[model samples]
Target: MMIDFMTLRADFPLLQQKNRGKPLVYLDSGATNQKPQSVIDAMNQYYISDNANIHRGVYELSERATYQYEKVRHDIKEFINAAHTEEIIFTAGTTAGINLVAQSYGRSKLKVLDEIIVSAMEHHSNIVPWQLLAEQVGANLRVVPITDNGEMDLEAYEKLFTARTKIVAIAHASNALGTINPLKQMIQIAHAHNVPVLVDGAQAFPHMPVDVQDLDCDFYTFSSHKAYGPTGVGVLYGKQKLLEKMPPYQGGGDMIESVTFARTTYSKLPFKFEAGTPNISGVIGFGAAIRYLQQVGMQNIAVHEAELLAYATQQLVTIPGLKIIGTAAEKVGVISFVLDGVHPHDIGTILDDHGIAVRAGHHCAMPVMERFNVPATVRASFGLYNTHADIDALVSGLKDVLRLFK
Candidate 1:
């Protein structure tokens, strides 16, 4: 069944608002998606009915809240096809998830002189965490270069792998360039060297169907906000075996099996990593977001996004002074481009006047922009709710900008 975007758009209440006296055309789902009413209502219902601290209270509300919270873990486990619900750890966001791995897995497993590999197209969230870990542990950080076309240089990545490579951390999709990396092949290569690979799936998770078991990645991180869930909630999916071996990320109330001054033992699997009060309502909302995606179907979403990307690419190419940044064969629904003689900020402001929203800046992938030798580009990212008319509006907005600047 074909999903009607007009009907789908109605689910997101914010989409109905007017921007600058015109209907808003939101194209910035790459940064964070707009929430659906179902997700919002789910969160509100949790706060109203099941408001209590989880895993601690003995009351009925606490038990129900705990059940709902853990149910979201099961939902996430199924959403990513994780081997076990215990393998899913909820953190603040992708940033926190990566940091948890870096501090727990990287610090405990990595020795001095061990190497970690990352790609040139990684967001700062993926890069900085490893860098901090490397600096702290006296380890080395190796970078995989990218080609001129914004795709990861597979040959360069192969050359960087060595016996000392303990971990390979890279983004499944580049947030700045929108290039989908060859993650399956990359995982195969990493496993050949007996190294674990961590994928930052922040951008890819929203647009594609992800199976952690199929990919066989050691760890995968994604933000709920980017996937139409609430902020302050994200998921980290790790292989069960590796997660058992890793130490606790943070020491707090829930992560303890026994607590004493002489001997304090940590809990098993995911609970060890997730300490302190979690985002209970946000996780409930995340489940609703996943349900929303399931109802729409990921394959259907991917097709619609691909069509929008192709149409947007074609329309932008027709303009005289516009250039799309990433021209990779495999891409998501993002189109990053530079307009001649106009800064990306200027283009964004002018487009905002037309109620056409787009992101303008480095997109937290400064190394990518540096590699391309440009400061930043205007990024128009599509979501499941976006339609061909949104692309037309964006194209028309860009044309006006070009005419005004020319």
Candidate 2:
């Protein structure tokens, strides 16, 4: 089915607003997506009608609230093609999820001199948790370096595993570069060496369809905000067997099945990981976001975004002194570039004057900037709602930047 991109753009209320007296051209979806009206209505409906805590109350309202919450969990299981609903663990966001695995599973299994493997392209969320874990347990971190084009070196990645390698944490797609890593092949290589892999899917989740069962990854995480849902909520999908063995990352509230002074028995698979009050409205709204994406279809989004990326790249590179970064073979709707004699921050400020919103920084992946020998790059990332006209505006705004700096 061909999606009407303009019709879908109207679904996002924020996109309709003017910025600096011009139409808002949003290109920073790699940071956070603009929520659709359905997501906003879903959250509002929860607060207006069903505003009770889940799992503890036995009354009618509480049961209704619990049903709305758990229904999203089930929807997420189907959305990602996970084997079981129990495998889905809710968290604050992708950062919290990585820290949970690093503390719960990494602390339990890793020993002194053990090794953790990660790529240089990882977000700080994926890198720092292991760094702290290694510092605590005397484990060492081995890095898989990227090539000049910002793609991971598969040969170097496979060679990093050895007798002491316990876990491999990497990104499914680079937020800074928009390069989609070969996750299935990477997972198979790690499994062959008796190592488990964790995938940071924050960037990939919004752009493509992911199947945890197909990839056979041990753990996968992504944020709801990046997928046109509410903020302050995300999901961590773990294998049932692995999660069953790992201890809870935090303790309190509904995570306990039974607790006494003498002995405390924790709850089952997912609940064991989720503690305290959650972002109830966010999860419910994420369900609506998932439904919206489903109606539009992921493959259709992919095709549309691919065209936008190509058009943006083709237009951006034609400008004199503008060099596109991360020219990988496979990429999503992200283009990072640098201009001669101009700072990225300056470029971003000038573009914003024309109502274009692009990110200007290392994008939470400083190592990527270091690898490219730049302090930062101007990144224009696309979403399903974006169009070729948005790219045209971006190019025009960039030309304005060049004229000002010249």
Candidate 3:
């Protein structure tokens, strides 16, 4: 079925606005996606009609709100093929999710002389938490190297595992370079040595289908804001046994079943991890965002973005002195590049003059820049609503940028 790009674009009110006297060309989806009208309306509906705290109220509005909130959890479980809804724990965002695992699971399992394995392309969120965990537990952190093309070195990854290895955390896709890692093989290798794998899926969730069960990963994390949903909400999926074993990340209200000065018992699977009041409006709106993706179809979105990537790559490479970064054999629609003699910040500023929105800098993955020996690169990322015309305008904007700099 053909994706009606025009119809999809209509759902986003921000996309309708003009920028700098030119039509808006949004290519910064890797950072955060623009929210659609459905997501906006859903949040408004919650506040307008269903505003109530969940899990402890018997009132009508509270019941309705609770039901809607839990419904999103179920939907996400099915979306990712998680084993059960109990496994889906809602948090503020991906950073919170990873930190929860790093602190709780790390404190519980890691010990002196233990090791944590991670890849070189990780965003700061994925890297810093483990670094802290290693410091706290007196464990060593091992990094898996990447090939020059930005693909993970599977051979090198296998060699990193040792008797001391406790866990493996990695990104499903590179936020800066758009390189999708081979998660299946990586997980298999980790499991051979009895290590569980955790995937940082912030960049991969919106652009592709994710099945935690199929990947056999013990834990997976992603943010709703990256997928056209509201900010301040995200999901963490962990296998039931693993989640049951790990202690509560925080001590607070809803997470506790009974509280006393002497002893406090925690609630069941999900609520055990979800402490205090949640972003009710955000979760309901995220449900709407997921429904939007379902209606549009993820398969169709992937095809559309792949075509856009190929066309844009062909056009952008024609510009002399422009070098594309992370040319992995398999990648998502993101294109990161360096134009000779122009700083990435300047490229971003110039593109904005042409009404093109792109991300510049290390993209929270300084190790990636260090590996490539570049301070930063200008990144043009795609979303389901992005069109071929957007790509054209981006290439045209780059030409304009070149004229000014070169």
Candidate 4:
């Protein structure tokens, strides 16, 4: 089913705003998506009516907040088709989830002779954590090289594993390149060597359906903000048996079963990893965003975004000196390009003047920038609310930028 871009665009309040008397064209959704009215209202309603701490309180308001918070976990579990809600651990965002696994699972499981496998397309979030883990544990970090087209070399990936390989951490999609990686095949290759895999699904889950069970990944992490939910809440899905074996990431109140001066006991599966007071209103709002996606449907969003991606790519390539950085066979709605002489930051400034918002920088993936041998690229990433007309605005805006520079 084709999603009505006009109707979906109306749901986002920020999309109605104007910049310099020009209507806004938001294309920075790969960083953070604009929220629907339903999500904003759901979060506001939680603060207005049910504002309280959860888990420890006995009051009705606290109980209601707790239930709503927990239901979001279940909603995500069902959304991703995970085996159980207990597998979902909420953190600040995807970076935090990766850090949790690195600190807890990596520290415990890795030995001096072990190696961790990652790809060149990894976000700094995925790379830095493992680097820290490797440095601390006296382990090696092996990077699987990418093809010129930005696709990871699967043959190279399979060859990177050996008897000492401990785990594989790779992104389900490149945030900068928009490549939808062959994760099922990658996971199978990793499993053949008895190595677990952690999929950084921050970019993948927002654009398409993610079934952890189907992928058979040991751990999957995504942030709520990228999926049109509130910031500060991320989902980390892990196999129950593995989470049970890994130690706690942080020490705090809610993550405890019992504590004394002499000895402290930890809580159960999900709680053990979740320390401190979580983002309550944010979790409820995250649930609202998931419900909103449920209404629009993931497959429909995927189809709509794919069409926009093709149209935008086709149009952007017509410019004289514009070069696209990633040209993989499969990608989502991201276009990273550089003009002949105009700097990406300059391009971004000119586009913003015309009310077209695009991202320009390393985009937190410096290694990807280094991989492409470019300092920076102007990136325009799409969302459900974006339309073909929005792409037209961007193309027209780029022409204006080019003329100004010329």
Candidate 5:
């Protein structure tokens, strides 16, 4: 089916606005996606009518609110193709989800001199939690190196496994480099070594469909904001067996069967992990966003972004003294590039004057920057609502940057 790109673009209210007297050319979707009208309405509708605390009150309003909230959990389970709804645990965001696994699973499983495997392209969310876990448990980290084209070295990745390898924490796709790692193969390899794997799916969720069952990853996580949903919400999918073995990450109301002066019993699989009042409105809005993506179709979105990535790369390389970073064979619509004799910050500033938004910094993946031996690069990431015209504006802006610097 041919998608009406312009019609879909109109759904995003932010895209209709102007910036600095020029039409907004948003290319920084890797940071966060602009919400569509439907998602906004979903949240507003909850606030307007069904405003009540969930799961404790027997009142009609509270029941309605609680139903809306729990319904999203099932929606997310279907969205990611998990085996059971009990495996899906909502957290603050991807960072919180990863840290929850690290504290609850990693701390309990790992021992002294144990190793956690990660790649060089990991975002700090994936890196820091493991680092803290290792430090706390007298463990070490084994990093799988990346090639010049930004693909993970599979041979080295296989070699990283040892008897003491506790867990493998990796990214489904690199947020800074746009490299789609061989996640299935990596998971298989980790499983062969009897080590569980956790995938940080923040970048992959926006561009592609993720099946946690197909991947067989022990834990998978991503933030809602990156997938055009509201902030303060994220998902962590764990196997029922693993979740049952691990203890709760936090203690509070709703996560317990009963509390007393003596020992207290915890709630069931998912609720045991999710303590305290949750992000009620954000979770409801996330359900709306998931419905929107399903309506559009994940394959359709992937093909559209591939076209943008190809065209943007073709146009960008034609520019003089410009070099693109992260040329992995498999990538989403993310392009990080550097120009001769110009700092990334200067490029970003010039583009901003033209009302073009792009990320220009280490992008919270300092190891990726260090691996490439560059301070930073200007990154223009794409989304489903982006157009060829946005890429054209970015190319024109870059030409202006070169002219001013030279």
Candidate 6:
């Protein structure tokens, strides 16, 4: 069944709001998605009826809360097609998830002079953690260059892999360029070199179907907020063998089986990395978000987003002196473009006056912006609830801005 945009919009309260007597047009899902009522209600219901710290208490409320919290783990496992629930570890967000792997796996497995490969288009979250890990361990960070068309240089990437390459961490999709990387092929190449690959799925997860098993990536991370869930909750999915071999990411109450001044034994998989009290309600709300996506069907969502992107791109090209930053054959719904003689900040402010919200600036991808020789670009990203009308509104706003500037 085709997704009904009007019905979907009805589920999001923010879409109903008036901005300067105009309907709100949100085109910033790449930064963060607006929550649906189901997600909000799920969180509120949990807090109102089942608010309690999990795992330690014997009371009914605590037990129910613990069960609900753990249920999200199972939900995530199913969401990603992970082999086991134990492979799903909830963290603060994508940054925290990547850091957990770097501190645990990178510190233990990587040696001095070993190389970690990342792409030039990576977000700072993917780049900085590896940089810190390399600094700490005396490892080398190798960056794969991108084509002028904004896709990763896969040929160059293949040449960068060697016996010394211990890990390859790359984004599943370029948040700045909207270029979807060839992850399955990248995984195959990395595995041939016996290197484990970690994919930052923060952008891709929202727009496409991601099966870690199908991609065969060693590690996958994404933020719930990007997936229409609450903030402060994210997921890290790793192969059980790799996670078991890696050391614990943190030391705390739920992470330990027993503690002695002499020796401390850590808990098993998942918990060993999730040290403290997690975002219970946030995780539960994430489960609701996942459920919502499942009902909408990711395949349908992808098709809808692709149509919107093509429509937006076509109309955007009609505007005089506007150039899209990325022109990759494979892409998500994210459209980053620049207008001649206009700063992205000015474009963003002008659009805001029309009740159209879009992102401006480097998008936490300074290296990509530097590669393109631009300081920033205006980014408009689509979501499941978005329609062709939203793109029309954005194009109309852009035309007005162009007229004003000219």
Residue-by-residue lDDT tens digits, candidate 1, 77-117: 99889989999999999999999999999999898999999
Give the better candidate number (3 or 4) by lDDT. Answer: 4
List, residue by residue over 121-208, the lDDT tens digit for candidate 4.
9999999999999999999999999999999999999999999999999999999999999999999999989999999999999899
TM-scores vs. true structure, each candidate: 0.99, 0.99, 0.99, 0.99, 0.99, 0.99
lDDT values, one for every candidate: 0.93, 0.94, 0.93, 0.94, 0.95, 0.93
Of the candidates numbered 4 and 5, which has the greater TM-score value?
5
RMSD of candidates 1 onward, in order: 0.8, 0.7, 0.8, 0.9, 0.7, 0.9
- Candidate 2 lDDT over residue span 1-406, tens digit each: 9888878999999999998989999999999999999999999999999999999898999999999999999999999999999999999899999999999999999999999999999989999999999999999999999999989999999889899999999999999998999999999999999999999999999899899999999999999999999999999999999999998999999899999999999999789988997889989999999999999999999889998898888898899999988988999888999999999999999999999999999999998999999999999999999998899999999999989989
> Which stretch of 10 consecutive residues in model 4 shows the poorest summed lDDT?
1-10
Q: Which runs of model 2 end up more than 4 angstroms from their true locations?
A: none
Q: Candidate 6, which ten residues in sequence have the lowest lDDT sum?
A: 1-10
**Candidate 1 ranges with C-alpha deviation above 4 Å:** none
Q: Which residue pairs clash in candidate 4?
A: none
Question: Local error of candidate 5 at 98, Å?
Answer: 0.4
- Report model 1's TM-score to 2 decimal places: 0.99
Colliding pairs, model 2: none
